[model samples]
Target: MKATHNPPTDVQVTPADLLRMAALYLRRHGWTQGTYYASDAPADNPTPPACVVGAIGIACAGHKVEHFADLDTDDRHTYLDAIAVLVDYLDDHYPIHLFDDDGLCIDDHTSPYSWNDDPLCTADKVIAALEGAAKEWDRLHTQGGEQ
Candidate 1:
């Protein structure tokens, strides 16, 4: 589960903060056992509650991770790595969460749709939109290219 793009280079939230928020989200979504107990599991038996896993997936695919360039490269790398691992974990456990009554999809607007009907183009769409916006900004600024 590679990231759709590089994580933001100016994010404000620390890795610790992301972890805490993720845990809180898990608990609020009824993944109490998974939220508090997952860290204790052995390597071969690591398992989060279905809802927790789904929430993680949604976070990975849709969460807003801010970008920050002030941090050292190592710190940014660690943050990116953490997100990658979470995405992989979620990918592996998707089936468990897809229909497990985890309440991850309580609102109709946010559900992950089937591939053919996916409303959230995610990676591709996001990049395209950003690029378009950047080009527009460049044009308006008239830095001597297209004015």
Candidate 2:
């Protein structure tokens, strides 16, 4: 899908905004974190899983599925492209580490935080990630404009 150049109307899209959008997209699809599994299907499949499409939607525009569902297939693909850009940006700047069921760090060799057991950790991470994205967005906007 081609990326859309249309920036969000608010001009102050936050990470939280993206997260909510992504969550909504995932919900529209059949993806649940609990049931998530690696898939070998092509990414551009018309009937892609909701979680995958949702993540792409989040990375592209911070809009809900209701809004996205209104778009044409090409537009949806463009939004997905935008999501790809967002994912690349996040991967470069705020890489998320995966943890095992026991709260042990699995992706990185670092020790797991004792606080990882607390639900607040998840909440805090979400807030912090979104805040960071907002800050980055502000920085980009202030420097020149959206990239």
Query: Which whole-number lDDT from 0 to 100 does residue 71 have in model 2?
Result: 58
Q: Which lDDT value does model 1 have at 127?
A: 26
Best by lDDT: 2
What are the per-residue Cα lDDT tens digits for candidate 1 across 9-66? 9865433344444444544433322232334445443334323323333333333222
* Cα misplacement distance, residue 147 of candidate 1 (Å): 63
Backbone steric clashes in candidate 2, count: 3
Q: What is candidate 1's local distance difference test score?
A: 0.37
lDDT of 2 by residue, 8-85 (tens): 675644444454554444445434221112154455554334343345454454433435666568656656444444
Clashes (backbone N, CA, C under 3 Å), per candidate, total 7, 3
Give me the candidate number with maximum TM-score.
2
The alpha-carbon lDDT assigned to residue 55 of candidate 2 equals: 50
The TM-score obtained by model 1 is 0.25
